[model samples]
Target: MPSDTLNQFLNDNLNELKEQGLYNEIDVVEGANGPRIQIDGRDLVNLSSNNYLGLATDERLKEVAKDAVDSHGVGAGAVRTINGTLDLHVQLENKIAEFKGTEAAIAYQSGFNCNMAAISAVMDKNDAILSDALNHASIIDGCRLSKAKIIPFEHSDMDDLRQKAKEAKESGQYNKIMIITDGVFSMDGDVAKLPEIVEIAKEFDLITYVDDAHGSGVLGKGAGTVKHFGLQNEIDFQMGTLSKAIGVVGGYVAGKQNLIDWLKVRSRPFLFSTSLTPADVSATTKAIDLLMESTELQDRMWENGDYLKKGLKELGFDIGNSETPITPCIIGDEKTTQQFSKRLNEEGVYAKSIVFPTVPKGTGRVRNMPTAAHTKEMLDEALTIYEKVGKEMNII
Candidate 1:
């Protein structure tokens, strides 16, 4: 029995979303979301996962995870502050610090929680956050939780950031000012101008926060966007994830020892949530070790990306400006974008359409993430399906 007010609120919003074609119907993947996947009894080439390095299915990670299960059983019993912090957790944090070239690092349950914990823990009512307009939803929520004045600068617009940062700094309205941005804009897949951002931060005495969720294991030879730009020491907070490239699940913040120390004690998620399970932590450590050992997987990922992007372009698709392996075929209308994705699925490719709310209206696209696991043959096959679908949908 629900209240009339509650029912009305739900019905109104549901109707609005449904009318706008924004109500998403999720499709379940029957197996791993590899280069090829199974959904609804059909085999489709998956182009939507963030597993750039393809380590998610690597034998080494499996070995590590199994070994962890044998040694440590399953879950962490309590929050990290109580009995959840195992030796594996410490080792994983240390491995992260080594991988990120930082003095220390702290792990979180998820990359989303990293933002939720880090931002609110440091910046408060007296502080202000200068955020990039196209930053992730986690970043937006984090800023709100901090109770700080969130000033949005145009995407990658350093000039505007400088102007606003100066205004915020001089107003005497805030005690601390922080400039936060995604290391790689996920929608556009463009790398952030970290060198210019660091300069601006220095000029304004602003704390720098870089959430490198997409950049880790993709850029900087798998270190991250900061290291890719050779500004590791300049950036105050370097946030990364174990889920994407690492092929595991978790996030980390690496920086000076004092920052890590403060976050460990104060970051809300770290203080309240259970630490990562033994298997996840173990597999993540193996992933980092593999990344550090060689760039073979990274090279393969880029090779596949280039091959796929070239084929998409040749097929008369409008692949957007993406410097990374990420490819987006721009389709102008939301309905058309959804149709394109449905056609792709029917034709055996699994690239999903991204429409409004994720990007501006009329900027609908089918975003593809090509990974190291894809072979030349697989990509060519997928490209052929894309071409067939494009012709059928008259998208090209």
Candidate 2:
């Protein structure tokens, strides 16, 4: 029933992607995604997941989720604007607000949804958004959805941002100007210069938005990059994901009560989409509780990250300038980078190759995500495999 034109387009593009080595073949994880994973019945040292705090598989979270399922059933039954808003959802929002040190918070189904909802909710055709060059795809897409004039400044170039802000403000072309950036650049693992950004926003009177998807539960003692720099009050939108470090399936924006109230009323996703299930809300609340209660997991996660980074760096791999636990082993050529990841898989490592569209054209890399669940022995084994493979491929 497919049209010939559509089939031709699909085939041509699929062939082009495969020929150019840009095609990403997703691997199936056979069990719970933890420090060690099983793919095709082969055990792998997992370094590709966003479960930063190891809470995804935590027994406490599992128990709470199961209890929620028993009590509330599986689904929310309808959209939030109807009768889908549950007490569990309210609790999760309140917990997120408390954990992030914000006056209030509103939850979304996912982090990507949060960006899509939040950005377009506040910004429109009359507004302008100053975005970082290397922000996440979701942020880029969200900005585009807002129909605002998107002015991209060089990655972390404060001077470029200030110049753009000055120009945008002085031109009087926009009714409102907003500066948006990732709290941590996910691909290269560099922390955003929030202190300088806040200063610029204050000077230009630009609304500040920080998408802290990667920074939440990783920095600021598990608070996030905003609280890491003590700028929770300064940033207008402190957006983050529960799926990353919080180890749940949702996202949220924590800020002033007025902003939260406005988002609840205006954000389309929160209004129209089916609400998060009781299990997810309950488990996410418990994750935030755990994060607020102790930093022991985060401490372990840091130690593991340092260990992996040191091992790779000592092996002469270009481990880019990462300020956090996310590590990217840069291997310039796309095919070679893919080959390196393929070899790693064969050797029991699961660090995936990030190429072209994910990063720059020639800066292909194998991004490693170390978590609190990874044992030192597992890392040592992975390092040994890296040594063997790097030598085999002359990548070292």
Task: Output the number of the TM-score-best candidate.
Answer: 2
Each candidate's lDDT (Cα)?
0.92, 0.95
- Candidate 2 has an lDDT of 0.95
Model 1 Cα lDDT, one tens digit per residue, 319-386:
98899998999998888888888888888888888888898999999999999999888888889988
The clash count of every prediction, one per candidate, is 0, 0
Stretches of candidate 2 exceeding 4 Å from the true structure: none
Model 1 CA deviation exceeding 4 Å by range: none
RMSD of each candidate relative to the true structure: 1.1, 0.7
Model 2: what TM-score? Answer: 0.99
> lDDT per residue, candidate 2, 212-285, as tens digits?
99999999999999999999889999999989899989899999999999999999999989989999999999
Question: Residue 115 in model 1: shift from native, Å?
Answer: 0.3
